[model samples]
Target: MSVRLRLAALGVAAATAAAGLALVTAPAAVALDNGLARTPQMGFNNWNATHCSGDFNETMVKGIADLFVSSGLKAAGYQYVNLDDCWALPARDAGGNLVPDPVRFPDGIKAVADYVHAKGLKFGLYSSAGTKTCNTAGFPGGLGHEKQDAALWASWGVDYLKYDNCNNQGVDAVQRYTAMRDALAATGRPILYSLCEWGQNQPWNWATSVGNSWRTTGDINDTYAKMLSIFKANIKLGQYAGPGHWNDPDMLEVGNGGMTDTEYRSHFSLWSIMASPLLIGSDIRKATPATMAILTNKDVIAVDQDPLGVQGTELSNANGLHVISKPLAGGDRAVALFNENGTPATISTTAAAVGLPKALGYQLNDLWSHKTTETAGKISATVPAHGTAMFRVHAGGAWWSNPPAVHTSADLPLPYPGAPALVQPGTTTTLTTTTTNDGVLPGLLGEVKLTGPAGWTVKATSPTFHPVLPAGRDVSTKWSVSTPADTPPGSYPLHVSTTYYPGKSTSDYDLTVSVAAPLTAGTTGLGDDPWLSADNGYGPVERNTSNGESKAGDGHPITLGGVTYAKGLGVNAPSTITYYPAGHCSAVTATVGLDDEKTGAGSVTFEIWADGNKVADTGLIKRGDPAQSLHADVTGAGLLRLIVTDGGDGNTNDHADWANAQITC
Candidate 1:
């Protein structure tokens, strides 16, 4: 089944599963925690600004907390001052309670909380739900002391708690987390709990009842690729997002340097549509004017804080051109037109295309321009290359001062039909639809009639505009026919006609349907895993082999069998490497690159090992070369080993590379 179908099936019981997975206890009733459910969270997290370098001493936090009130952020609806990781010392006091690091937070967390609370803003703190504080610089982990930690936070006046999955792992991840959730409740403090487990456990399906929101992906970097990837990855989880619970794609990367202003606006637009937490990660003290404008765009922010709280959905995509439409409060709709290709292309669609009913008329409000104007019935526009156009459609004058804009459509139903169409059997196709109402009015609807040859049946129906157009609005609709399975493998012409009312404009569009037989495509074996290698002088160097030498990073590969043991496969090199494998393998194992602290890239080779034996070994090598890289294949059920030798072949003493290698997968 499709991923969407799977998620829909799982959506119903997702909360129950979360409740079962979460640690349950009588929850605390802290007064400061009651406001989150009523508003879209607006706050600050230090990770994007300072990362692991985040510090929260009296001097630093007092200044930040003061800035929270003075910087207009508080007035603009930002109230939470969250301290993310790295502020705690290694151990707790004799009372078995976690304590702030004296060097970093000398005044004590309670004092800091008091100061923040006095400023009219709430204070938030971080911790892990595991035995070890998350990977932050010694942030405390409330493993065995969940209840104690929860009480401490409440006593300290914390209004929000960011519970992360720092050192916690294994099958019991759910239970370990639930323990902290229940503990926080016992404190009688209604802290706005947040889950930061990076979505590994599909938190959206079960995180709402436990916390306000959960990170749906790994920490996002300050780059366009990183930001966009996280955004796109959460699209499938849209159904689970709402006012009380949200799917977090991590904090904003707006002014952190990897993109341009337009891109940032696009970023904010998408986030708004997704109803994601508007937690600014940039340094508020030094925010450039441009960055502030992007973050504080009143129009976009309005959409984010919209009362309806419905997340946007992907309407359609053809040949790299994509469209997403969202419903806004006050009978309006938000549409995002995008071009994901290298070249510029025209992305045209009517109000009806997104499912605005015929009874409604819409005015296109350019969010960036902050201007509201009538579309003159011209709801289509061309999108630029690698760019986007975002507009807020206000229904006919209901909420807007002006009327909808109008542009003439000379080629009645432009783009002459009889075009080659690809249709799935048993599925009805939606034809291009449009709306005439321009300003602040509801959507309209027209009739769609389809004519196809005998034997064709309509299994499912769709509007050229998704979200069926609401009634009583001024809108239009087109129709498409679904062909039958027994139809011959040839072109079959079908007709799609629309009848507009009042004005009574009749238009007919033709589509050439091809009943092409489905054919199976050939496949290839698994591609080489980036983690393993069999090149250079490092080929399956058996642990007990005479020629093999045990080296620093190469000593004792963790496992006994599987690709995890591949010789040159370990990444002790300075470069970042991400290890993932195909299939339902139990573990993934590899050794570190044994090269000495020296830097510079060159040929690096390694051998592949499975079940403690050599499976594939490479020839003469070099790093970056297709053939010289580490490659491996191993059973998901067992161990693997690799004994890599640094530099090139025989005779020359190599930098400390791998030798005594083993891995557990």
Candidate 2:
């Protein structure tokens, strides 16, 4: 929940208190009390994944609704099944009324809406408040036909309306949108109104009473960078969103292919904590299990739907690390430990940093991992690159300061990059988990179990059953864990849980088990799709292209010093990427320079690190400078790190490229 300020468009009229142009200064801002959107709206929107494509049709809309119930989205509290642009025909009928696309909705719009209503779901559609819809195809808009279009939509049982900002014809944004808002209200039917002004006029400053939710930023694509950018802009606008009115930061892009699974989880976690609208932009009918898992996580979704209607805030965002805190009902706090770096990091913060009251013991419920553990006061996690560690923290009321101490830990020799075999695949390790009754009251211990993935054998080597653990006492259990012979060599996560008496109070622990595998050896190797970790200054790090713009897949070919390289990383300054050479690589080399796209306005320094040691440096490489050759000796190094630092000045136009990066193995 890092706060960010965005660029502005022209024709924006500055607001002043003397001009009577009201601005939101506090949570006292009032919303249209239509008794709708008591929480941020949730459901599906066919925009990001489908866009203005031909595949968007009545069958697709119906299929989404059918999948909502069958796929558990409905049971997960998704109420609206909405459709975005391209749903209307190019022209209206003879009655001067908007027309549903005849080919797409052959059965008519009402029939499709009626079908959705019949399935116990609400319906929504899209249009614009201007002369034409956003589609360049020139579909009719609701500019001069507000009342007529609103009446038509109410007749079709449309439950929501997303009024966009295109073709406004130089009209004042407030005037134009307010016209549609009044038109929809006068229709005598309740329709949740969403203002999609793209924050051009600073909608959050004045749109509370205008609609149920107002788009506070531009459209969102499915990329880690884009999602992160939107969260930055919206998280600070929490004072503007409430029960009846919300600030829309576009829609969800969970299942889209642009980002990794870990990034998608962070995206979902941020949106849920921010209380943003959860409009799934992916095609649910074709969603993968990983995608479905992210969209249907009820524990996280509960934070978004928490009746408190309080949006989360950014407690801190420093040096690519971020912490977000959302207050939930019943004195619970939803905390997010987000790592924006391209390297794995242990983000640590005290409970007080997250606005939690002092307590003897606190329960940290891992929303993503679904593990509950007790903590004395600290909240920390070793988060992966572009990953988030989310927890629901609650103060333990009756538990003593020390609480019931349950520690599930295992120790094995750490593996070296190329040292003799250590903890190789198909090996057995001993796991020792201990539990102690440090609480004031005596407690009876329940079953203590250690669980791993399929094909992994786990046997209790020591006694696990402890009927009663009196005060100031402890018990220990050891389990023999073996990896499957066919198991692929990589890091694996294992879980163990132990419960105690009285309320069946539970404590769960997570541990990582690494199995050493041979490293892949190569020359002229590059960091591409399968990056171990990454963090950038502006947008995503592109492959084989200059860091061109703020969107993924929007980069030019890798050009530097008037020469082009086929393999390298295109990144902005203030970036870091970690690669696992696993001691197979002896040297790391690259041709580095500022991308030609910057002309002569950017400056940066590129450096290479081996196992936490700086090995190569390109100091103050500016635009139009000759490409510099960087070679780092990474002998016996487990990790090779590439870094791009802004040259003293801020990171403006600082797009640097590593051309023809290679590893000598």
Candidate 3:
């Protein structure tokens, strides 16, 4: 049978088994009605938003859950107040019971659950499939205590459990998580189980039977690359996620630092289109108006929560720039055009590219614009630099009262905003134009028309369309303004126009676009390299840092190089190697350094061996080095050791070293 079919059968068997057990008891017990009522779980997480320092307690949780309801978040389809790491004490009670840190959560889990329940919100906690939980420093390991801990959580009223995998042993991640599934099932509580193994084993196929959602990638930081990387990886797992099970790409970074408003909107829109779990990881208490709009965009959220449950799939991509399309339940489709490029890039997707009819007549609602429009033929929109444009396309005349309203800037273009500057000659450039769209109808699409002087000829044009700009919307399309090779240096006027189509009407802007000298290489500080400023190579996995051991109900005690890193950025590595001193492994060394300096490119490598023979290997990593946060599975028996080295361009001192590594599996 096909792998997909096999996995589906596995899910049926697992669920059926669990159901049978329940029937033998009460006969009425069943999988809790925990399907995400909406597309995205529009809610807040304590980590990115409040951080661990917020000292989230019963009062704090109640307040946040209440805010979710009072502020129309609940009405906007936001649910779940996920409590990230650091809420448990360092040890379990004498009865081997896990206890919340009194100072952080004075009222205990039950009280906090009550408060969240009162606010019409669900509560979620974090754990790991390994011997230690992600918050092991405070809580205990679920490794041997899966059954007890799960039952304990159910007793405390947790409606959702975010099970992460830290200090886990090997590729047996599927089995590790299955243990918890059995445990949680035994508790007789229907909790929304979310697998957080960072996509190590392609959890999409194995986790459906165990969790409501499984993380398809690593933990997400507030940076654009971090978010983009996670999203890009999910393209291959698209077909595996559905209504009850999803491929979580990690929590939303909305309202978090390290990204601009435009970037955050792109983040939200893309996540919505992916049909991934929407657990907000940013603070909600101090959310800005723009952030609020992104968090509660009904149109975008609709795409995520579409009843069709078919996760979005990547259609096309290049140089980090990509396009993903998802079909909606109402015989329509939602398409997200993304430009992950450091410099602006143009991207387009006609209905036909994604298996839809070209003449279906489309409704282009700028997710960021929160408005709608209709197109008879092809509809296109340009993605801005490191930005995204998400649209809800439906059969024209299907969901319209009186063609959607359209408008460009009611205000005229402010006097020519000076001449345009070329950041990359014959490649790309940034152009600015004023419009009166003011976020009305389906925003405006900016376009530039250029004319060359006497001898100078217009070269290939580089276009960047802002996704639902500050007050205007840009149409999605490709630009072609070829420049004459080695053309004479001369001044040129590029005509700029901003077009708008409201409902069934279309408008265009006419203005001057002057060209300036091309920008020198690297002068713009922004170029084609998206990995700029990224770590040059892999580093060592700091033992006790990203690796730990613990028992469920017994707070995890991670001895990081003799110290404890129980807070922010805590310590993460792609993988951790523990030494047990046996078999071929006589000695081990963990080293992280730079590589490819001679070629100006680099990579991170985690090398493992036994008696001079390579035993395990982790490939190149472009994200960061020191081997931090690398996810993989290995094969072998005997001593497990490691050495992390940098293969990317840079200095040798950039390497990280570890003398001993261990494997509990």
Candidate 4:
């Protein structure tokens, strides 16, 4: 006895727009306020688990809905039971209304919606924003019939909509998606609108006011590279996300079999920190124990559902190791350390480097291992290959007092002017940081300890300067810092700490040193520009390196002075590079090119501004085009700025490079 025949037959009423029904369009200045999904939406979708199999019938949906209640998933905040593609009839009925497949959905969509509602769960339906869905299933997409479809779904009590992109006939994405948004608003129903356009149109820039959650990348497979690539792309778009608007990096592939458990943990942890929607794409009816454990971990989920709604940012991606940090609502922070290398390695970072206050100690709670420990600013974890170590850090207490006010400043012999002191790899540089005591009583200046990145030798030359510092007195210490010859180009943290009496209070001074790649002759106009190697809001400028064709910035190759030189500054579109002369250079010039070796289907517009004035503007440069030469007379200019934007098509492969760049003093 098949469950389809045993269920009572049901009919769906045709839905039509009323006469003189004013179409409620999305507000230009704000997003649709459905008052739902204020945080990332949690639920179950059947795409990764069961993609359009014949068993995707009303009975299976009902079974999943029942499990949602019985298996305690609802209690854990998993609500929506979404049906992906293939639940609809091949074509519309006589009245041009969408029809569910008779054999699969014997009781119609409204009945399923009602049943899901009866269990206190929401019902979600999937449709293509294009002419047809990804598969040739019965689903007739809502391309030309957005109004009709929105009305029907609203009438059927649908609570959520996962609108995908497939077979869109060269139509503009913003227009089609905005049409659906306006149509859904016209229905006067509070449906959660999800934009699934595969992140093709840079929806993070335009879709905030249109949908609740917009996918920021293409579909994610259950592989390590696919999952990691999606995570990297989404993390960079954090500035565009907030409450009511989110950057969706596709659904969760945590329970899928393509990756190991360690890699899956990394996937889930990164996604949680990024505040992406935690829609599980696994079969909930028979979830494995490990999958269920990862999914139901409330501590990890709390990070995603944090009330602050701020997305995390990548702190570092050097040497195949990555660190990400997110600020929580209660002044706590979430940090994730990912080891992308093939071999297991020990990685460490300081709380100050992740934007925590330097003077305060922190209590760290491992979100995955559930271990708790307290640290005096330094945190270290040995992670497995392709694994992640995540922690929630709470401010424990202040280690230093107000009486012993310590003022610190760094002095480098050959300063790069306005930028931080530069330390070339394989060279010893003496870093002198002076600490001044402005307290009421004398204090002892104890030993100074310096901690930096791995493979770097940082020793305090004046370790035991037990000088009695009277009130209003100051003392200086020097550290001999040396980097390995093969250190990657980035800003590495150089943390300086020491304990002094009367109370033996710990004083900490945090600073950064720029490590530049050995530049070749004739590569730049200036011998070694400090601003070119340091991180200035945008990530550290990599010399002569291609961000590579694989979107994840893997296997980067070197570029030199030629038009096809292996390295320069590589950036996606909508990025800015500002260089402060720091009184070091008077004029700057560079050859900007769209990398012919790495870029595909990328177009960019480059602009140069000197002292707030537009100096040069390259209208548009497409892939394989000749490089654009530009020069700027930056005499007496306080700042020089370079802006790169997508050539009116959204940033897909907008890999831009700066070649033969130089500055003249």
Candidate 5:
């Protein structure tokens, strides 16, 4: 049996977690009282930014401590200032004690600890449970010298120990980590014990009393893919995180410059809701406004540090969209609407959907936007690709989980079929939005306004306000929206704002301002003015390129069977794209294969459906082989679907490509 399943045999709670794994908890008699990291330790680690670089010296460490206070990070609960690997020399001293690198820390480890302590910040050091550390420098680890190393760290006033797993020489992971845990306990010091075991041995199943926080995934890089992967790995283990012992999904990559601000905000939101340790991994000294704003989002941080010790659980994960709910201390719910898709889409969940009790009106606080709005009951947002919309939802209050946000959708009976109705330049269309009062109480609906690009005319045709909106009802507000005469032929952003309580509460929705295609029908298939009704995947699918690692990054050319194509769609595995054909097309053709990128490490299957009927399929294509050609008949099909699956294996590098995809009438 897997280690996760074995938790029941180890006197752990037999109840299962949302991930369907056995929820493990240590016996009350054995709960470790390290008196540290009661609510997922918040701090900074130098590994992500410095990584043993020349600049990661005493001066840098001191600068971080100084900035921590001046930058208001300490006030926001970022206390510990920790150092990662490579602080020590490759060899120990004559007495077999680990020696600080003279060039890096001239005054020894204690001096740096003292300096940090002077600033009212705790200090941490890094080591491994094996003979050698993980880095190539091969610094000596504390494998056989657990007690001795623990004493030395305690003597230096080290407040935390991030003990990694490397070069274990085949020792059982539990035994190896437990040895260091006992040693730290023996020191009679209150230093926090962190297990950087990388979840290889299912630390969540057994590390409750062993370490304060254990790494549940591999190292995190400054990329959306890595962050999302780490989140997926750690989100399921929420049942294990509590006051003292928590799950560590590596460290934060906030100011690392690899991802967009939107993605960084999503990362921070996910980490916070999961109750993971909030360790700032970037160099705060060089942090920008965007990075700092994301790092110190106080409302979101409050959710992370909620004294209840309850981690967020996934309410729903469907079609690359996720809704997570974390129960706060005082009956508040921190709801996260996360979109893992490549395109912007609306993600939402009602208060009732998140298990909140019935209330008159729910006040919604947008944690990222920092806007206070009220929802009759619905909670949602137009979450961007790789973005998250966090809301502190409660009935109404000043405590941790208070408020509900609004949920808005386009009214049915659209003028044109399919999503994102195409409209001509300079033309006016009647737009109707459904203003919902899903709350249990009556609501006062005020001015409903629609704002769009400059020069676009958007005026409400119907009454802007319905003084009293009853519970579980919707008000359809119609607006005459007109585009500029010279409007561009691309998707635009339009926001529809509705005030429920005049100046006090409001709700908003981001509407996709779709316009006419620049070219109605090009030689390429998708250029034929076909509207995309649905597209969802693990990662965003790119146009005319192979799938990227994450986000809508510039992907590699569509190469299949060693041939590069100029026109096609690049998609990750488990992807589906439904195209609304503008006119009758006899058939669709394409060369399907795994993209040559990823160094030939992918397995995928491409399938096509016409009018809900499976028309063509390239079953099970692996890497390093020629492309498979596909031709699907769709004589009278109004919709065509392009799908990619992970070939019955987990989607690791499944970058599937549709090469030279075209349609023939």
Candidate 6:
């Protein structure tokens, strides 16, 4: 059988097992009937901004609860306040019951839940299905104490539970989560169960009956790339969502400072269209006016809360231009046009192409601008870079109806070569672009021009030419591009435009030239390596800092002999980095270290391989350890590999760095 089929079968088997577990006491019935969250749940979760910080306490939760009522959020449809990880004490009490941290929550969790309930909002708490939570404090989890914990939470009037996945002792996901589901049902309380497994086990396949909502991706940071990736991944999983269950792409980072206001609107619109649970990850107390406007838009929220409960589908996605259409109740549709590219372009489409009937006209209303227009055939707009235009289309057309003028007779195709072109610093490269006339018309003439960054020099060979570009004909142009010696490593935008004769029709093509850092011989810093890639890893390599481990003194420099190396690569746990020699190199040597300058608390085993063969292995470096020197013979070898792994213990502060790496021919 195919892998996908096998996975689906496993999901069905897991669901059957969960049903069997639920039927142990009584006949098998439907999953917990929590009348809450009939639509995607709207709430506030604390993790993105304040991660395991000591400030997450009773006072803070009450303050946020007060803000929800005073700031009009409760009336605007947000009703839950969730306290993420680190809410409990490090150990259980003498009676083996989970205890709230006295210092953080002096009034106890029951009092806090009462405060939220008094405000007409629900209370939620965080816990893992394993032996320990994700926090470094090692708080008690709900692995063996599911029945006691569920009963305790139900007694405390808990309305929601965010069950995380950490330290799960190799137990199957279905069994662990099903045990919790059965336990929660036994309590007979209507609590929303959210499975925060980070989408590792494709929870959507089996989590429909197991959880009210399941995270479809890993945690999201406040960046355009991260938000866009989550949206793209969640839009394809619509088949598994319904009224009681939803696909969660983690919390919303809309009001965060990493992205601009325009980008945030696109983020909100896409999330609403995908029918994702809109869990606000920002501090609502200090939300700016612009942020408030985007969050409280009634038109967008209505589409998300529509009774249909059908998630949106992608209509067209090409060249960073996307169109997502969500079917709403009352025969209306919510559409979003997204420009994920860095450069502006004119994107056009028709309503019929987006699953709307072409013969029947519709009225388009822009959700952000609150403007309405009538169209019969096509709608076109010039979208800004990294922005979106959202609209709601009704089935009937009205006054001031004007469709885009249809163009026939001629078509122009402008295609650029080597998209996202890569080059080394201080190097010269050649860029070729082609323009063609794929139409029946005879007379077509145009000129192509290239524009790039300020410090770089770009000159085209032809620059100015009036060619007799006819039907099904093409022409190519070349440009000599060069960057300065001190050019920084980043993606630089390059715009190419063509203007034709007669109609003076213009077309644009956007290109990004990536300048890579150069790696040479003699004392090359590992962090400064030109090419760095990771498998089963995240984020970029850092200079003098650990990537995932945020412990103090874990980001200090590495010292060997008299030279102190401050730049290197830091990984989470089991990750490998393969280095490709820039030029001809026979051997490479480096000093590897664990943790920071002061001391190393975690152990990491380092291995070096050359051309698929193991060259060296440093057994295991323990805490408070110095640097270890290792060398690998790379004679005629195309690649050199460096592997670091957690040494028996869990991946806490497993920071491994290679210092003062160099290549010798």
Which 10-residue window of candidate 6 scores lowest in summed lDDT? 18-27
TM-score of each: 0.58, 0.70, 0.63, 0.58, 0.76, 0.65
Q: Write the per-residue lDDT of candidate 4 for residues 543-585, one digit (tens) a residue.
A: 5564443223442443322445543566545555655564445
lDDT string, candidate 6, 1-665, tens digits: 22433254234221222211110111122333666567899989988767878777888899999998988888888888999998888999999999988988999999999999999999998999999998887999999899999999999889999999999998888778878888998999988999998887887767766778889876777766557667777887775666777889888887877677878998998999888898888887779999888888888888788878878777788878888777777766778888876444445566666555544456777787775545553554445567777878765555234321111111111122111245557877777766654333433467777787898888877544656655445577777888888888676767777677545655555565556553565556556666533421234345554554333244545553335666566664455665555345676676876655334367878887665577788888876666788787767654566777667553445556767666664
Error of 2 at 314 (Å): 2.8
Predictions: Cα RMSD each: 17.3, 7.9, 14.7, 13.8, 5.9, 10.0
> Which parts of model 1 are misplaced by more than 4 Å?
1-35, 54-56, 169-171, 341-345, 376-378, 381-386, 398-665
Across 486-520, the per-residue lDDT of candidate 5 in tens digits comes to 98666776787777653446666666655653323
**Tens-digit lDDT track of model 2 for 1-665:** 00111111111233213111122223444568678999899988888878888899999999999999998999999989888888887888999998888899999999999999999999999999899988889888899999899999999999999999889898888778878888989988889999999887888766776789989776676656557767777887876677888888889889877788889999999899988889998988888999999999999999999988878878788767888887777868888989765444556666676767777777777898786655666677656657898989887764343334343333333332211112445778776766655444566765678888888888998887788866555677888888877786566766777777656766655555556553466675674524455667666888888886567789988888778787899997667776666677798888998887776477889999876678889888777789999988999887667888877554667888888888777
Q: Candidates 2 and 4: which is better by TM-score?
A: 2
Model 1, 244-274: lDDT tens digits are: 6777878887776556665677678777777
Better of 1 and 5 by lDDT: 5
- Compared with the true structure, all predictions reach lDDT values of 0.56, 0.77, 0.55, 0.71, 0.77, 0.70
Model 6: how large is the Cα RMSD against the reference?
10.0
lDDT of 5 at 73: 98
Sorted by lDDT (best first), the order is 5, 2, 4, 6, 1, 3
Worst 10 residues of 1 by lDDT: 18-27
Top TM-score hit:
5
| Candidate 4: regions farther than 4 A off | 1-29, 397-665
In terms of TM-score, which candidate is stronger, 1 or 6? 6
Question: How far out, in Å, is residue 611 in model 3?
Answer: 46
Candidate 4, residue 334: Cα displacement in angstroms equals 0.4
